[model samples]
Target chain A: EAGVAQSPRYKIIEKRQSVAFWCNPISGHATLYWYQQILGQGPKLLIQFQNNGVVDDSQLPKDRFSAERLKGVDSTLKIQPAKLEDSAVYLCASTLRSGRVYNEQFFGPGTRLTVL
Target chain B: AQSVTQLDSQVPVFEEAPVELRCNYSSSVSVYLFWYVQYPNQGLQLLLKYLSGSTLVESINGFEAEFNKSQTSFHLRKPSVHISDTAEYFCAVSTANAGGTSYGKLTFGQGTILTVHP
Candidate 1:
């Protein structure tokens, strides 16, 4: 079975520029997630979508970041006026359900964003 | 709120040697613990997890972890690691919020880089 898929494995942008990353989850997966992993740190959940509806986004920076999963199969995360602090790898993952090991998630090759 | 801490930032060992990666966690409610491994330029993969059963959990690759409730720790250990075992390891905690949506939000620790040399 194919794993989660992401686009533009690497990206580079200026501090004030805008950037967007894309993710296509595993087939038949019902849950999708976006995470940000800064260098020297673990990945932090940025948002979660359960079949096109947001399940959680409390940690997301609304002022600068936005994400959407219109069809519930693929997702896109965007950051406007990117800051140096936003330089990190953005990972996407998928699971059949929420909050259970039986629904273990499979992650994608993250898109590394470098904001200069 | 749930948080995880990995005590070691980096551990270097020769192949066929024993190694342990220590993890500590704090949470307001009951939680599930997990260990994840990531190879270079790759995504995170689950190694093992502790939910409600036995305190000891073992992965298919001969790696094991014991969940210690009193110490609030879940440490990963391998008696004899191979060179292929070199990777970054993460400890994570997840909890179901009492009032909010029932999704399990995972909090991960600063990863530990384990390097096994031949």
Candidate 2:
């Protein structure tokens, strides 16, 4: 089975510029997530989508970041007016619906965003 | 709120040597614990998980972790290491959301970089 897929494995942008990352989850997966991983730190959940609806986005920076999963299959995360602190890897993950057994998440090769 | 802590930033060990990576977590409710491995330029892969029942979980790759509820710790260990085992190990925890909209929103710890030299 194919795993989660992401685009533009690497990206570079200047401060104040805008950048966007894309993610296509595994087939039949019902849940999708976006995470940010800074150097030396674990990936932090930025937002979660259950189908096309948002499940959680408490940690997301609404002032600069936005994400959407219109069809609930692919997702896009955008950062406007990027700052130097936004330099980090953006990871996307997906999982099947929760059942009696716990669902395991599969991740994609993240997009390494370098904001100069 | 929930949080995970990886005690070590980096660990260097010779090939065939035993190694352990320590993790501890804090949470108010019941949680599911997991260990993920990320090779250079790759995505995170599940190493193992502890949801319930047995406190000890083992991965097919000779890696094992024991979940100690009393101590709130889950430490990954391997009897012998190989150069291929070098990667960043992350510890994470998740719990069922009260609203029932999601189940796997994970809170991760700062990762531990394990370098196995051959």
Candidate 3:
């Protein structure tokens, strides 16, 4: 079975510019997530979606980051006015369960964003 | 809210030697623990997890973790490590929200970099 897929494995942008990353989760998976991993740090969840609805996004920086899972199969995460601190890897994950429970999360290769 | 702490940021060990990576978590209620491995330039992958029952969990690669509820700790260990075992290991905790939904919002530790030299 194919795993989660993400676009633009690497990206580079200048400060104040905008960047977007795309994710296509595994087939039949109902839950999707976006996470940010800074250099030398672990991955942190930025948002989660169960199908077309959001499940949690409390940790996300609302002012600069946004994500959406329109059809619930694919999702996109965007950052506007990117800052040097925004340089990190954007990981996308998915799971089989769509319920209010937890399951094994499958991750993608991730998009490495470098903001200069 | 839950939080994870990896006691060591880096650990260097020789091949065929045993190594342990310590982890601790803070949470009021019961929680699920996980260990994820990230190789250079790769996304994170589930090494193992502990939900209930047996406190010990093992991965296919000879890695194992023991969940200690009272101590609020889950440490990963491996005997006779190999050079290929080098990677960043992340400890994570999952807890239900106010609405009691385990939405997969993992609280991860900073991470432990394990380097094995032959």
Q: If scored against the real structure, what TM-score would every candidate get?
A: 0.94, 0.95, 0.95
The ten-residue window of minimal lDDT in model 3 chain A covers: A95-104
lDDT (Cα, tens digit) per residue for candidate 3, span B1-118: 6779999999999999999999999954668789999998778899999866899999999999999988999999998899999999999998866665665778899999999998
Local accuracy of candidate 3 as per-residue lDDT tens digits, A46-103: 9989898998999899999999988878999999989999999999999875466688
Q: Which stretches of candidate 3 lie over 4 Å from their true place?
A: A98-100, B97-101
Q: Which candidate, 2 or 3, has the higher lDDT? A: 2
lDDT of 1 by residue, B1-118 (tens): 6779999999999999999999999845566788999988678999998877899999999999998988999999999999999999999887755443335557899999999999
**Window of ten residues with lowest summed lDDT in model 2 chain B:** B95-104
lDDT score, candidate 1:
0.89
lDDT of 2 by residue, B43-94 (tens): 8999999887899999999999999988999999999999999999999988
> Candidate 3 at A104: error in angstroms?
1.0
Which fraction of the native contacts appears in each prediction? 0.60, 0.70, 0.86
Model 1 residue B35 CA deviation in Å? 0.8
* Clash list (residue pairs), candidate 1: none
Per-candidate DockQ values are 0.56, 0.62, 0.73
Q: In candidate 3, how many Å is residue B30 off?
A: 1.5
- When sorted by lDDT, best at the front, the candidate numbers are 2, 3, 1
- Candidate with maximal lDDT: 2
Clashing pairs in 2: none
